[model samples]
Target: MQRGKKKIKEWKLKDEDTRRQFEVKVQQKNNRNRGGWKQLSENVLEAAKEVCGESTGHRRRRRETWWWNEAVQRSLQEKKRAYKRWQRTQNEEYKREYKEKTRQAKREVARAKRLALENWSEELNSSEKQKEMFRIAKQMKRESKDVMGAKYIKDERGVIKINTEEILGRYVTLKTC
Candidate 1:
């Protein structure tokens, strides 16, 4: 039994070593075909040549005039003048439209206020009798019986009274008056 276990352990070790060797060989083959760092360096060199004009078949040229100097001054001044003129015209048009709109709005609000006042005055005059009837109806509805069968009463002089059945419905008026 011990000899059989030793044989088994040796077989496992061989299998592991063979697998590792195969993996290493495959990696080496892939690296060779892909040209890893050498291909990257070649591409970088070609890009540098193109950007620096070494591959364009022409010598590098120098600028004759500086961009921010006298060559651009006249054009810049002309642009500034045109911009100022445009701004003035726009402001004038905006002011005119704003004033007209504000005037129209004011007129509309004043007209609405006048109409509201006229309607209110007409309603007050036309409903005078109706209002008086409603007021009297409301006052009568509010009267109630309380302790000792007493009922609240009011007179034209603004005096109030509480009359009870025990007093034979006789009322004693109190001044508020």
Candidate 2:
């Protein structure tokens, strides 16, 4: 499928008529075929209207997930409302309160997400395949692999063994290889 929106009459013919021989013939043929101007203009207008309709039409629904539940959304909305309220009043107290609420709400959301991941990890710890997947996920979610001190690595000898290291070299190798 095409990446962006398609527009009518957007096919710009080659400028300066590179085909010197066929240019005059093409222009003459185009001029002679002028009877369809009324219908052509109407079609172009219709197309323009269609494009406008798409822009002004009912908004398309977004894909949502159960993970983005009501409580978090409500907290976010409340934070925004607090900020807006501060904006309206320009009161220092309101601004401070908004900042505090925002930090609290954000921390709450992050804590919830971390707790969910921990719960999932606990459940998946039973299976070897799941443990591997969890490890991969942990690696992917980490800000830096430098924090992975004395990490386990699958060696060239195909031995699942522990190897101690200060840093894990780089995540690029882990992702690519």
lDDT of 1 by residue, 1-177 (tens): 112211111222234554465446445555555667777555444433333223222234323321233324444454455556656787776555555555555555566557656654565665774686578678777765343653565554545644454233333333221
TM-score of each: 0.22, 0.36
Tens-digit per-residue lDDT, 120-152, candidate 2: 568675686486787878988785655646445
Best by TM-score: 2
Give the root-mean-square deviation of each candidate in angstroms. 39.6, 19.5
Top lDDT model:
2
List lDDT for all candidates, in order.
0.48, 0.60
Clashing pairs for model 2 are none
Candidate 1 TM-score to native: 0.22
